[model samples]
Target: MHTPSHDWITTPLTAALLRGALDVERTAHGLLPHRLPARARAQFHDPQLAMAESQPSGVRLAFRTRATAIELDTLPTKRVYAGVPPRPDGVYDLVVDGRPAGSGSVAGGNTLTIDMTVGGAELTPGPVGTLRFAGLPDAEKDVEIWLPHDETTELVALRTDAPVEPAPDPGRPVWLHHGSSISHGSFAATPTTTWPALAASRGGVELINLGFGGSALLDPFTARALRDTPADLISVKIGINLVNADVMRLRAFTPAVHGFLDTIREGHPTAPLLVVSPLLCPIHEDTPGPSAPDFSRIAEGELRFKATGDPAERAAGKLTLTVIRDELARIVEQRRADDPHLHHLDGLALYGEQDAAELPLPDGLHPDAATHRRIGERFAALAFGEAGAFAQRN
Candidate 1:
């Protein structure tokens, strides 16, 4: 595809405007978005870490162009969960001049199918594909293509009818957020519609999302990454991952929380730092984890998570969702006495028992698309609204 005014000029996708991913690696074919830097990634080889970090949640290409037609070539690694409904193709959202203009999806890509029952995964390789968009206004304007939050994508090339360049910073304050899978867009409908994405949109903030799936376990490395990242506003949503993964007992958790915040404050002592607790997860509220799948549903062509740890274990210092929330609240209250910018938001305020009853979580874990929308809207109103914490700054 060629235009008289311009020959194809493929700009090297550098880190200048690639907001979400922490690091990009040169792959054999193209570039791979790694949520964690090489130093951190080298420390852990867990498949869960690999899968979550590679999803590229909140990743996108942002630039300016006069092109009426644009083509993006990418090699995506799509995930398929066996026995559950086939996940839809990951969506790429195109925003022209700050408003949604169109959307596209790559046709073919590699497939990673996971059988949770047996804890096995297999990848079937596929080839690169292109997403072409035309019929633009044909004037200089900002253009953004948000990559699918659920799929890992490798950029092959980008072409356009007109020359492309980095989009100018819009001067919005950057919001750097870190949380668990729910924040990583577990069941959000599209890349831009993820709860955090939606909230960022409504709040009019530049987003640098650090939302890793099950990987938000308050690790020192993640804290260091947050410390190093530049931002005007920062938020850390904790608790859910700790409960679900059941990785630490209360003895380790309390101080871990302090250390995480301590490290972040090292770099951003005055930035508005909001610590969010877990939302309502009934199964894990009183019961401890690590959560396991209910295989009974697979027989019916469905799958859901169930808490496996005994509730009685809580007396022995086992962490549950309930216990985690109280601890987080206490920690934030104690710290805010000296750190005035620090704050806490009960995750239940985002999604409570009533909200769950109305918009039930399909997997007994992650919220569905509708729930995502509700939470996004509420969060925008609470955290970004006129009387909200981010309101005055923005």
Candidate 2:
């Protein structure tokens, strides 16, 4: 439906330029991103899994080129959660030679409508949209186009004025991280602006993110997917989704964590692994959940959430942020004796009460972009600083 100007060379979209995604599905019009490889994706049809994996949370297109102009055609599935303002179009970030160069947004694409009250959803497909960038330095340089973190983006065509080739690896350690919706980038400004992405940037490592929005429930298949991926460093942010989802009790949670870690160790036995507990979510602090949506302000286009479970339920093995944090700390400590590479990072260390007083969770659940930045900076210092867990030995 469009015409190319002046001898634009189109290169096949291959793994060389794409990072963070586990697999790509060849579609009639383009390629769909998948956090879970095809084998794992085929193991489950959970809608949460489908949405999370396809969102392309940390996926980006990177290459070395001399082109002053570039264009990318993609089909983005934008989500509109009921009772809230329509989410804005996803932003694609342009980074040149490690510096942010420019940004572009795709206007029209697919739309996925979600009704939290009834827990129903439907997708309406739209046409492919184009993202264009120009005014480059016209010198051989590394370029990256970070895809939208929240929207499901299917990359279609890539056109540039000059020849493009795979960017040379900088020989940086690859950091693989997994967590819940927060890590999946609920309110991050852009794909590369996610907390993990920020941390990875500060840490100076390649990133492979498996942060599945509501689907980071410590599933075995996800563990296997992480196990198979190559990583020099690993971190797993646990507890929030488990507590919020109200999926398992203490009995089930303990064994599940053990099994998840056990599976990951199978492939990355000696890799430095950090176990992260949930951040301070006020609603689920002492209270357990199945967090209920607050409809009182929904009419005003404000979406708020409140804990629905009882505080006293903790005595009955009901999970809460406090309970999960304590358990995760204890689990990591006990395991560290046998697994020297294992470490524990309390979520509070990333976003504790004092910080919350200043940068409160806007929705009473997810952190705003500012908090994400703080967490990322703190994490970078904690895990990648000289005395940090992932610090360079030399």
Candidate 3:
């Protein structure tokens, strides 16, 4: 799986090597990023990708490089499933320089191991281990590694023998977004296909996805995260998660949103900041969320979970997607006079009536991959197209 740069492979390390190298750290995790290998037997949206027998999930490391040498370093980590007996299965496929260099796993007795087949060395987890593939063929090569059903794995570090490419050209108007797990690519297949990534690719912009799973709570941390990040276009997909998690009351939600938007505006004064409401979730569409049912058996004896909110409570307008969407529209309208570039896009436009009817969400909640693609296409056209007014904004 290794291909050095054709003619450039013969060149010696130059001044770039003497200069400090830039490390491109791992971005998304296996299940989190929804990446799995073809051989991976079974997969699900839960945090871990469960595989039967020897099947495993795959992880790829890709970085644009102009460096002569590159190395990958990882530490053994395990995931603990909180089942009856606390099942812990830790196994990973280590691929470096495009070849299967080694395999790491938790032995039958739950003993951790790093087994290098060629050297017959079985090292346990104590000191950090290094798997180095030297003399990479070219100035740029992707070092991919795959991991199976493993618990919380930490990519310890990445080191380069030669200099790396300058950080992805920042000249492109970067779009920084913070949203729910859906934006984080819940069921979507690939990293690049996530709504945000897809929109960025189509819009020809750089993207920094701050879409933490179950974490976009009109919180100051998220607003500050966006405020600190540099971006030409900004968007916050709010509502679905708030209603799902049953986090805030309507009274508190409004001001919290205003504060969140205010914080972002401080950093990006004139940038077009699009506020997107939740896509239609049938269950939450009619019935306000904080869905309280033990849906475990429905998913095959899986653990039953209770979402926040009592429909009766929402009678008091505690928290509802409808309420959120209405208020978001109001918020943008109020600000439009003062802040001309601020805009709002209803989630329905992305996956509204027509799209929903065509691509019904598998569950009553999240849209499938096809729906995601449709959403991306529509978003690119409406929100970021050549005629998209955001492009004209300062």
Per-candidate total of colliding backbone pairs: 0, 0, 6
Full-model lDDT for every candidate: 0.88, 0.90, 0.56
Best by TM-score: 2
Candidate 2 Cα outliers beyond 4 Å, as residue runs: none
Q: After superposition, how far is residue 260 of candidate 1 from its true place, in Å?
A: 0.5
**Lowest lDDT 10-residue stretch of candidate 2:** 385-394
Candidate number with greatest lDDT: 2
Taking all chains together, the TM-score of candidate 1 against the true structure is 0.96
If both were scored by TM-score, which would come out higher, candidate 1 or candidate 3? Answer: 1
lDDT of 2: 0.90
Which lDDT tens digits does candidate 2 get at residues 245-271?
899999899999999999999999999
Question: With candidate 3 superimposed using the best TM-score fit, by how many Å does residue 260's alpha carbon deviate from the native?
Answer: 0.8
Query: Scored by Cα lDDT, where does model 3 land?
Result: 0.56
After superposition, candidate 3 runs with Cα above 4 Å error: 1-71, 75-153, 157-163, 167-170, 296-312, 387-389
Cα-based lDDT at residue 210, candidate 3: 58
